[model samples]
Target: MYVEGLLSSLTRVKKARSLRAASWDTTGRNNDAWNIEPNETRVLADIKGPGCINHIWMTQRDGYRNVLLRAFWDDEEHPSVLCPLGDFFGLGNEIVNSYDSLLFSASTAGNNQFNTGCALNCYVQMPFNKSARIELVNEGDEMHRQYFYIDYELYEQPLDDEVAYFHTQFRRENPCDGWGHEIRVNTPEANIVNAERLAWDNNYLILEAEGRGHYIGCNLSITNFQGTWWGEGDDMIWVDGYKWPPDLHGTGSEDYLNQAWGMQPNAFRHNGSSIYEPDTDGYQTSYVFHLENPVRFEKEIRATIEHGHGNHLRNETSSVAYWYQLEPHKPFGILPVQQRKPVLRGEDGGWLINETAQTQQAEPTLNDEMKQLKAQWAEKQKTEA
Candidate 1:
């Protein structure tokens, strides 16, 4: 569904004011990337709106989980959106294996070569009554060079009181507890045995909130070391105080993400796999945006999934859930930089092969500045604590 930009409904709207905010430097010679200093919070957009954000596009040379992106709507102290910059665009784990979907898409240049450039884009319509502010804070060790464009529409009239605000939140639990490989079983057997055990006592939280709105969708990425496929887990969504048998439940992880059988790294216009690691085995990224089948909620919604049926499979999982909900959202965790970064099993003090470090294909050597800065930051934090 390629939108003919010039003829799209966006520009065709009668009597609406359109605006663009870009990082265009005053001097054309060095006008590209916005050099965002480490530990600095950059205000990306601050605009009064009774309008809607039509599209947002950005790219930066920084690790995904390292740089945090947040947004506040209608002058609320609490942000409506909070997640890793890359993860926010369905590029979790900071690995930019180019992917494209309806609302989110990202790609890296020179795919097979070294020193690849990155491109990220998102198109989620956000409506607000009073105002909207977006911020990006660099939590990485070095300064990040960011380039962005925020496109929005200002309407003549205020938004309807019943309209919901867009919200997105990220969550992760690396290396979730898994039963030993010796006990690993097939999907059918696992489901039957884990049926009752698939209770909500232990499940990955995709989106949890007390509000009235329908969920749009989510992007889920998994890094598994075990040989057993992790799709045995089911999607269980509880709406409005569901206790016995949730209001919505799916057969498996792939089913919930709107894929059948196994998943391939095919990035489609709406729902499909984003990344499939060939160099690193057992890594895959999937995304789905619910347009026609969006789940509605009157009071609350708990979007969750079992990482493995009966919580038997263990692996690294990261996700960003998207939806539009009432004001005053439930709190989203703001993990420290170190905690946000992915970790491996055992006591090894290093990151596994990920978007940030495709070291398996090439050496991911950090310069002296970054090494020293990370060390200094760690020491400073220890002292402060």
Candidate 2:
């Protein structure tokens, strides 16, 4: 089942990497993480091409949404990946709860304890033939500490020209432009498109890109102030040159991600709803990775969905769309912090500044791989004796 690749036969290879921090002179002793000042743009990675990033790890303090992450591929002027640091790696609500997925996941370092705010990991392979640039911007009123590691492989084989570049974009709409009980615009003009229309034009757009690549999936978070079900809307995607009534139409919000009935709180490996809120008034977070079945498009792609049946419901929705496209990809805009923040059902949720391992009563458990290694080592010792 596990066959070796040509790279495995290579005799010689070179690796280039950087573990950026505040005090590089400390020699991994006193200060290891960088304290990013407000409004400061910290260049995390500026690496030569003919390489692919295999892994990325990061840990940070408060102001999750206040910290923005952007990456530009092939020495592009604009960023190919841009989103709040937390949300970019599937921590949509800005609050970290341990969840596992194949491509992205985060964990509390001290065995489910809050000792480490969040130790994040991403396994998305981003290959570039020319160059790659990554930066972190602190836009909060105060500074915060950030530690990160970018692990990449300088390939023996030159990266293929068809290799797509990675991209992530963020969008948010508070009380999406919708028609409630009272309609302001003329109904005939709105309905004229297709005789009868579910949404005149106010569909929530997730991503619109022009290139040849496949979608990797997206992270979705929503807060409903109304009593109605937030998932009544359907997911619509227009690929290539298709117009309205997108080429790919989903049944419902939950059904689109393969969830049924209603959303529930669970961290499944591939897809599942993770965060439901401090208020039942309508707080939800769900993510689905199309790792096995990515949506492919050749020329252009426009992904969207309605807020409700016909853009009739009003709710706050935010998302992070991930995809891979050719070089010189279309640039996207990141919404301002004032608009990017989610509208909670109740008061804003605050996190503990100083969390300790003492708060967690249960002992941390070792992963299966570690446990297997330990057992093998013990057995080897007995045989050596």
Candidate 3:
């Protein structure tokens, strides 16, 4: 939002010393990039702190979704940031469409390659008191040639005790357990006439953390498999211990991303849809950064969304949640490399339907009257057709 005078702070008396860790040719040659072999992990930045990482810029020949990016603060055993390299940068599903955002961006060669050479950057402030370690794990089978820079500001004084550590976690629900796949969205019969959400045990979880923290936002990616509009779900975020009624309940998917009607191909500083393929080949990527109003929490936060109205649409979904929290964070382990791999796109540039894909659907316990209503609705559809 600081559109005009963003550089005004540059004139202020700077107290911190600027520093950087980068991949430079030790031989003073132009071959500065490192070739990371399969399964090889490289330390991008390991620095002592009382420092704040101001910026990070990186590029690789083919840093697809299989590559894992992790960051640990204060030498913690578990990393605070763990996400697919591409998702962490903004785009998702290994499909790169470069766009600039306030916190993260990807710059491409203008060809719009699905997952190829691109420069990725992150400008989220990451202040650490003791130490910080950033590593990249090449989980794909091919060798990855990567170049990078981690710019930080070293402070002579220790960071404020109240300063929280930055954190990110990725999650995916390939073919989210959705009921009523046979039903089309917006159909009269598809309406939640008798539906009710007694609980959110089956919601697609974007983040579930147990600690003192504030959720900044998340990047959500979806590939429509149902052949129609794939965004009829609602966003429900629970901070502290509220159950049935969440702390921040949203109306619909597009509404949650700050769009109306449907998602558009737009990228702004705080909120916008980075990718919007709104057809049967629906592949959309959107983000919402709560920079001005972070969802604060004292104990915990559980952020989730429905796959469709009442959790009734089946589609591929994945996301990365960004936040800042205290140390000793709850361990949110990531999916295996195989599971984290991007789903193959069809010849038509849509996700290939995987019939054998496992589903995590949680069918609600329906009473006799509700079950009868559902059966009657099915029979009515057959008769109408």
Candidate 4:
């Protein structure tokens, strides 16, 4: 009987539990599930399931804007189980620590609404062992359809055995024009020991992160074109500290640090704006930089940019300057070790670019919060051990 009970419990936990129709719109109008308008609103749905729940599905009305989705599970004290949608893709990190449902909003114009006419769907799934799934459907008369599926599975043991690995697969189909879409993976606290971006044959950008306790990785494909011409593209990086003057020639002091760096025409240009002198027969070039230490604290900065233009391209500039967290490591070298294979994968998709990886040690000084988190993670390690 005891064995049967345990097996039943495991089976119950493994199966997904969903919200009943009676509780669909407990907080708002009876529009089936959460009905959000042109403004940002937080909604909650009680998730009841056994075992570690690891997936979430979100469906929005048509014309949604600034849509932010998050998930929190009932684990030891209801700690947040998923990273904020913003921080997931190096886009933005805003912590919305609530045990309820995720956050959603319409665009600034208030013209775009979610789940009104057609369904706009977003999903979050854990790729370890735990699984959670949420889905939204629109019963109204709108002409938009956005649907995505995120698969999450948990391994009994981590890949490296030292850190936990969360593998995510996101697939989306949007038939509307001028609509924006992105898939993000966020780490609540920044402990990215090292991050690298590689351009493969001018088609995709592979973002890789590595460090103790966690590793975040993603590949972003260049699909649409808006402002200017479009084709396969190259990749670029922007450090935190650097600043690019708007108008270089009109600037007061030509002796600016970046100006000085720009004066030296090495294999690559560090600062200032320059156009691809098509008449000059501009050839392809690869740029790479590596910081010595991992970024442990929360900071907003542009890390890299992928230049997508024809041979005679212009208007390329680096705004922010980055200081090597590690000592005088070379900026231009063969792409880092982990990026080579992935670069090939990207090239298969059509981005033509080289790879360079830099390795160095960053300064040892860490902020108080980072130190505290490290300590807590360490304690958790000890308990698990």
Candidate 5:
């Protein structure tokens, strides 16, 4: 059991002392931030605990997706929580939006500026028995000044054996390995012979874990590449090594994020889209939290979603999965800093796919309207000549 809501548990006296680790100026000056050099890993909080982290608040200039946030539980060799600073807060793709959620939120004064104006906060409970080490790795080219507060509680008594350590991991598929988008969806040409998918291997993997854990939620960001509509992909999750026809299967991308026809600008306590901009050629960041209904697994869990129905659309996708599990978690390596940044769109208005220095442009596919405009423009040029 965790002491989460203050108003609900205010009457109960608890045997825990409140504490905080912060980046306040040591000399008591106005410069209350750490100047982290490029490639420097700064230890934000190193706490010994029979305790739980109650809250985390951070803000910095240029602290977009370039800065990495990591947390180690019980002095574990590998990090339990590893993600980009911006993605971990909720949105993705180096985007900043003002949205409020139950467990996570980012606030901006106006215009969504990153320099001191955009404040990121997390309210998830992170319990540890031996030690907890939280860190920030500056992956950007220049030194970044960061300020933060890791507020936690120390308990004289040991935590319950059933308590699970918090964990998170970020993943990305810059232009997912999807089939060509030349054919229109739902047509006979699009639904070719043997269209049925028998394996989940090709789906965009959101999270894969070994050991007992319950998946709490995830934030998914997608930059639509072959855009007419970019969200017909079904969500399929396998729990405990189940075979095909997963235990949890969803209808489509928008439905999985608790949306209907298309993504809209909305933010709710449990599910919502933080950034929904179609004018920017379909950049969407949405999240769904399993606060009341977590997906539990004993041995393993693999969470994924199709790019477009039957893996038919190539798009840039990234996500961060949050869950709680026992120690000795599976080590999932973070992508290099360059690869982690959002992939740039090529001149052809498609993703410039980069996989470990090998760069290539994805073949652009125009929608019906775009194709018509192209034809019209060609005719006009001929007439002028």
Candidate 6:
């Protein structure tokens, strides 16, 4: 059955021959005419990449006011186990709403920096058994020549089969000047931390940080782009499938008590102000997260802002592009050590709570039910004997 599904998805791409070569004219516009809608519920395409096949599902609704791009591994039965390549932000239960606008553009003027009214040239590259790299050039405004790179690696395990883990990193490069860049994780439920600048290597700015769980998110934005003309950039990590408190709060809800939940260093600003706002403008951001240890799977993501510049306001023309590593039978739900201060209360009996004591407590109801069931089975066996 799985083999049949895989073959069906592969043969579903009607325009496979057109995409054999790297052609900008074949992307983002009417020329990119692959849709997974109507009678063809599933759309699959084979691209020149490290993967056997890539599955793409296109959904349109409300008189075509909305369009969605859903991509996953063609080999996996459970597509949700893989990270999707598009604006996938919303309550955990609901379908992830698509980006308001997604288009592709090109420029011959070397570095294609993002600016107001500037279009972008973007696409996804999935390689079989190898890592994929995306190239971006700044063309619009020279003042915004700064670019950010985010890479994601997704992995899985064999013991437990419920969840998939992701390890992601971000890198920012300033080509024109020393500007401050802000990195924002769109998902509300992400635990983000350990942001710092490390040593540079191979013309890439290396920033290192660690985060676990789903809602843990991170971002890096250039504040003042000075005389630095494309050196290296910084990096950060995103661990998926784990949920934290900040992610529970949803988007734009500020918690003063949880200052650590916000951006670290808190020193640089876009316009010399100490405020960190999410980038709604259409710019390119990449993400990669890999689940290491126990199981090994890798996921790669690329997000590009298609239209305008950052004026500290929201704009359309943004889209997310991604690829995934799918491995079945991976164990999940191993919680990481909490880094924030726990909520405490004066003990008046009932349950005395301390950090160590609280950690020792077993899960309620579920554990009790299992214990009762075991006791009942034991008694029934004894009676039968």
Off-target runs (Cα >4 Å) in candidate 4 are 1-31, 37-40, 45-51, 72-124, 127-229, 235-305, 309-385
lDDT of 5 by residue, 222-339 (tens): 8776667777778898999867678898988889988898777789999997767563455778999988899998999999887777666667788999999987899998877777
Clashing pairs in model 2, backbone N/Cα/C closer than 3 A: 198-310
Could you give the candidate ranking by TM-score, starting with the highest? 3, 5, 1, 2, 4, 6
After superposing all C-alphas onto the true structure, candidate 2 shows an RMSD in angstroms of: 17.2
lDDT of each: 0.73, 0.69, 0.81, 0.25, 0.80, 0.23
- True lDDT of residue 307, candidate 2: 65
TM-score per prediction, in order, is 0.83, 0.77, 0.91, 0.29, 0.87, 0.24
Best by lDDT: 3
- What range of 10 consecutive residues in model 4 has the weakest lDDT sum? 175-184
Candidate 1 structure, TM-score to reference: 0.83
Per-candidate clash tally: 1, 1, 0, 50, 0, 78
User: Predicted candidate 4: what Cα RMSD to the true structure?
Assistant: 22.3
Candidate 3 lDDT over residue span 15-81, tens digit each: 9889999999989899989888999999989999889999999988676687899999998999999
For 1-385, candidate 4 gives per-residue lDDT tens digits of 4456513755545434332222244467654544434333333433333323233333333322134333333222212222223212211111111111121111222211112432222222232223233322222233323333332433344223222322222211111111111101122222222212112222121222222222121212211212232222223322333244211111111122123312222222222211111211221111222212222212222333232221111211111111211111122212111221111114344433332311222223444654664565566558869
TM-score of 4: 0.29
RMSD each, Å: 11.9, 17.2, 3.1, 22.3, 5.8, 22.4
In candidate 1, which residue pairs clash?
95-355
Candidates sorted on lDDT, descending? 3, 5, 1, 2, 4, 6
Better of 5 and 6 by lDDT: 5
lDDT of 2 by residue, 167-196 (tens): 998987665665441221223211212111
List runs of model 2 lying over 4 Å from the truth: 1-26, 109-116, 181-200, 278-281, 344-385
